[model samples]
Target: MYCFTDPWYLPVDLKLIKSIFQKDFSYFNDHGMYCHPKDNISMNLFNLVNEDWKNLRAKLTPLFSSSKLKSMFQIFVDKAEVLEEVIGSYSSRNEPLNIEDVASRFTIDVITSCGFGIETNALKNSNKEFMKCGVETFNPRLLKFVLMEVVPSGILANLGFKANGAHTNNLFNNLISEVIQYRETNKVFRNDFLQLLLELKQNQEMTDDQIIAQCFGFFAAGFETTSITVMFAMLELALNQEIQNKLRDKIEEVLEKYDGNVCYDAVMEMNYLDKVLNETLRKYPPGPIIPRNCTKTYRVPETDVIIEKGTRVIIPIWGLHRDPEFYPDPEQFNPENFNAENKANRPDMAFIPFGEGPRMCIGLRFGLLETKLALIKLLKNFKYTLNGRTKVPIEIDPEAIFTLKIKEDVWLDVTKI
Candidate 1:
């Protein structure tokens, strides 16, 4: 069923997805995600294709090397500690906490420091410039996203149709350009993402727009996805007490190995914790849909139903993750599904929270490790359970663009362990 179709906008099955991503990839290389080299030069990686994307990916890959992420442990720990303090205040008062709000702010701080080499302290100061810009760009209203996703560029351009809410976009681009200028002028060096992007702009003739585009891409891809994953992980922990305790035990056991400190190695060592995170993403993936449009005419093999040029194709990652064939008792949250032995046996493309192919999320390591550290700190200091203030069944905001978020809030009660 077509997603934009009237009534129910469900997803297509996996067979169709494999053809698009794998077997017939040549025909579907261009995702046609919103792009404007003139107006939205900051919209880079998501739209660029062929040589442009390939060259940039090559230059950017080494910066995100695992060793680079390992060097970022201090940033993760510092931000996670801030989050813990905020949660500590709530736990002390026996207050019912809307944890997602806290998690969103925590991720904002993490993304800010990592993405721009700036510490936002968003939890303490709600109006941080970087955090405000990030929210504005990513979680646009549903109708807006749909128009951008479905409506042709010709229509938008002819009608002078601009997406609502450019305040953040303008603010962020200005901040990034200023930061880049400051860094270049002073010869300032940092191991964070901004430093790497600066290296690109200097070494590669990547225009200011390209530089800003990469920064915006990281901000869009990093913050919301990590926050959603963190909230879902917490929700599962609150609902499934035994699993929560087990995960906590794994986190504690690993941290004990590293002198009660959460580091990259300690996080990686928590295999069970990894499985839990994977399972959480499987059930409540932040990016539920990956939409791509055919850049040129293509043929669907075996069937004579050739998809004409410029047809819109939607890949329902959410449906595939929930498919009963791939995961028996799909609704049950079982970490064992991602266990080493089981994961080895699963199909290559079966798990795609981050999507597949050459265009997989560039900031995945930073995003995942940040979330892991936050969860470790929270689980170590506090134990949480669902509070009565929480909506009984989570209701997704049909308005928000990417995240599978609730219109109300996800509330939880916590006690100091």
Candidate 2:
């Protein structure tokens, strides 16, 4: 496929996709996205290529380990409780809730608290600066996206073009600097991502700009992707009452084992919830496409076609996910599609909401834990149904460049169970 003069190889073959992501990763290691040297926030792990990505990933990997996430689990529960209160107010008034907006706020609070070690109280106060910054950061401008793709990063940097707006860059820069300064001055220590980053900085393993860029990337990636997953999961559950009820039952059953507390272990015990989340990801992956850059000339396995270095590779994740060959009745929102037997029958690469191999999303576990906690909190306490305001068949926003988003707000009628 050609976008203007730039050619992209859209590979639909699963075997080739696997090789691109894993086996032949050395040839396709970079994402090929433009990142201006002037844009510090854009130089995150997601955008960095080769050694930069590798070093940063190695340093940050420990911060998201099982013990680390368990330590952060309480943050998820606390924010989810706030989310429950916000939803309860709407349920009391018999008002339908725009779940996407509410979930976005919930995730904002969670990410801020967990990642920045600060409380933005986004759920209670929707007009917070963090909320505004998040909205602006992700606002899809088609022209900007196209220019970034077609133009070179150095040229863009020379022309004073950045990946993010001035407001976003300034807010994150100032906010992170203030927090780091305060923590150092007070000798404060917190078991959060920022604290870990500070330790890395103290050890001279990371520079100030790298730390700021990572914090920005953590917020930018963490909140929206998890919130989108929560929103879509709720939408699907509302549309499929039986699945919703069954999932709630599983949640309750698992919580019972933990004395009715929604702990890390209890959430992990809910295998059915995993299946539901997997199915939701399959149907509405946050990132519908995976982009990779060919770093070296590579010949197609068992073919004469030679993909030149610098060629862009587009792994059509959405197309493969919805293909009828892998998923019979591809349009159906059935959790059973992810059950042990069914999943075993499908190819491993067929289900990649998070891209496969090394460059896959680093925050996969954190994202899933946050998303599952939100669903458990909401479903265990309330019964939700699709409100009339939501379109019967939701439409995907054509302008959503980065993530999968519904064109219309997802409104659901909620009643306290």
Candidate 3:
């Protein structure tokens, strides 16, 4: 494909995507999205160069391990409990709840807890400064989007244009610095992502900016994706009562085996929830495109085509996910499609919600865990129905350059079950 006469490669076939993303990974080491090192908030795994991404990924890999996730389980549960209370109030009011806004608050609290190592009350105090700052950070204006995605990072930096908000960076940096100083001054140790980064700093002598940049990345990247997942999942359940009731029954039954408590183990073991999540991701992947910059000349396998270095590659996830060949009745919100039998029948790369191969989302585990927990808790107590206020055939916001979300609010009527 040609974009403004520039040779742009849009790989439609799953095999082609796998080839570019995996087989020829060496030729496409960078994401094509660059973050100037001087811009601390932008120097995350998503924007880091080849070697930098690899090393930092290895260091941060341990933070998302099962053990590490379990250690942070209470933080999620605590936040979910708050979420439950907030929802209960809405249910009592017999009013429509804005799932997008509410879900954003829920995820913001979770990400802040994990990233900042502090209990954040975004659920209670929706107008919190950090919450607002986080929203602005991800909700890039048109100019910012053009500057970051269209223009080269080097050019943008030279022009003194920052795609990332300096206000957002300062807020996050100040927050991290304050917390780190408190932890150091009090000689208090805790098991969290920040603590892990702190240890890495001590051993590797990483700059404070480096650590803060990652923490800021963790906060910025984690929140919206999970929020969108929950919003869509709930919307699907609202529209499909049978699925909702069945899922609720499964949740109740599973919680019974675990003493009626929604623990990490029980949540993880809910097979139906897993299927629903898989189906949701298939239909509404947070990131609908995977991007990479070809760093070396690479000959296409079994073909005479040669992609020159510096050529950009785009893996169109939306097209693939919606393709009827891979998913019959692609628009249907059926969790059955993700059942073991059906899943086994499909090609591995047919679903690339979190991308594929080595460059896949490192935060996938934590993100899934958070989504599952939220669904378990939300459905355990309340039921939702698509309200009149909700626009059917939800439209995607063209403004959301990087994520998939409704342009406006997702409204649903809530009732305590």
Q: Best-fitting candidate, measured by lDDT?
A: 2
Evaluated at residue 214, the lDDT of candidate 2 is: 93
State the lDDT of candidate 2 residue by residue for 91-194, as single tens digits.
99999999988999999898988998888888988846777666666764888888888888898888877687778888888989899999999999998999
Better of 1 and 3 by TM-score: 3
lDDT of 1 by residue, 242-319 (tens): 999999888888888899967677788999888898999899888887766676676665666667676766667888
Clashes of each: 1, 0, 0
**Reference-based TM-score of each model:** 0.91, 0.98, 0.96
After TM-score superposition, the amount by which residue 281's alpha carbon in candidate 1 deviates from its true location, in angstroms, is 0.5
Root mean square deviation (Cα) for candidate 2: 1.2
Tens digit of lDDT per residue, candidate 3, span 86-166? 999999989889997888899988988877777678799884776666567768887666556568777877776655666
Q: Tell me the lDDT of candidate 2.
A: 0.89
Two-way TM-score contest, 2 vs 3, winner: 2
The top-ranked prediction according to TM-score is 2
